[model samples]
Target: MTNEQFIERLQQPNWSVSCKTEQQVDLVLQACRTAGISSDKREEIIKVLRLPIDIGFSKYFDTIEYAHNGAFKFLELENITSWFFDAIKKE
Candidate 1:
């Protein structure tokens, strides 16, 4: 789905599970850990991404993973700002 569509879906939470989606979430989480983003930073990224907070933080990772499934690549401090802007863009 497009970023706009993903943002729209994020407004309403859902609980359906997909194995691939879970894997993607895990991938992102692991990347963050490897990059030393810190737990607080990870949580903040989730918040910045506008993911669901009702679910535990672990589960919150899934929101952005599913929303940007095929889009995320290697993340670094230098590129993260632009990446976040791109991910949250309305159009």
Candidate 2:
């Protein structure tokens, strides 16, 4: 997906679990891993990302907000996008 598409999807309020949403989560996590994000930091990201959607969909918004706010300190937006696209291509 294009970065704009990715961002648009992320901003959507729906956090219902589906094959596509699961794939999106996997892509984000894989991107982080491929970029050599530290395990501890990845775990932290995971914790935020995995928060239950049933609990008001906070986790979905929170994860996107965290990424926008520089949770992955070493990664540039371009790098994150690149990693995400690479992960998608690999799948």
Candidate 3:
């Protein structure tokens, strides 16, 4: 999907579309490309997303791993989109 369509999807109050991990990753990569996110930053974001979460420390860490695999399961589309925005803003 185009970046506009992707952003529109995120804007929905109850967007519940589910995708496979690979598909979700691909969509984020495509969105980054469409947004002109630099290669290094894109790779950094992808690396962060792909990192394994340590279940033992889920209660302590505020990192994406904790958010994604923690009790809250907060790695939904909106959250991922927010991460992408944050990645873009990072130096």
Candidate 4:
């Protein structure tokens, strides 16, 4: 699919939200599943989607662990995205 088409698919609101980072990663994963996106391709796709490339599987797992530990609050996607971007920039 073209980047625009893949992006349209991702914005369809077909998925649920529990953890912000996990849901975003899953959305990209599902979009890439049929297209056979490789690891590098996955990162590129996320960049097109305007998400931080560093917010990959490990970050999703960390989000889940944080939620499980009762250490997270629901945040807007924009907030989470900005926070991820800032966190990566700091590192």
In order, what is each prediction's RMSD in angstroms? 14.1, 11.4, 10.4, 13.9
Q: What TM-scores do the predictions have?
A: 0.25, 0.30, 0.31, 0.24
Candidate 4 lowest-lDDT run of ten: 62-71
Tens-place lDDT digits, model 2, residues 1-91: 5655654443444232211244555555544344333255544554455432111122333433233333333432222344345536755
Write out the backbone clash pairs for model 3: none
Which digits, one per residue and each the tens of the lDDT, describe model 4 over residues 1-91?
3555544433432222232464565554544343343256544444455323223222233221112222233331222344333333453
lDDT of 4: 0.36
* Per-residue lDDT value at 57 in model 4: 23
Tell me how many clashing residue pairs each candidate has. Answer: 0, 0, 0, 0
Measured by TM-score, the strongest candidate is: 3
Give all candidates' CA lDDT scores: 0.35, 0.38, 0.38, 0.36
Error of 1 at 86 (Å): 17
Which scores greater on TM-score, model 2 or model 3? 3
Candidate 4, residue 11: the lDDT equals 42
Candidate 1 lDDT for residue 89: 50
Across residues 1-91, which tens digit of lDDT does each residue of candidate 1 receive? 4754543433332222122233334434543444333265544554455332212112334333323332223321122333323444534
What lDDT does candidate 2 reach at residue 49? 54
lDDT computed for candidate 1: 0.35
lDDT of 3 by residue, 1-91 (tens): 4547655544333212222365555554454445443255434554455433211112233222222343344523223444444543452
Ranking by TM-score: 3, 2, 1, 4
Candidate 4: residue 60 lDDT (0-100) = 30
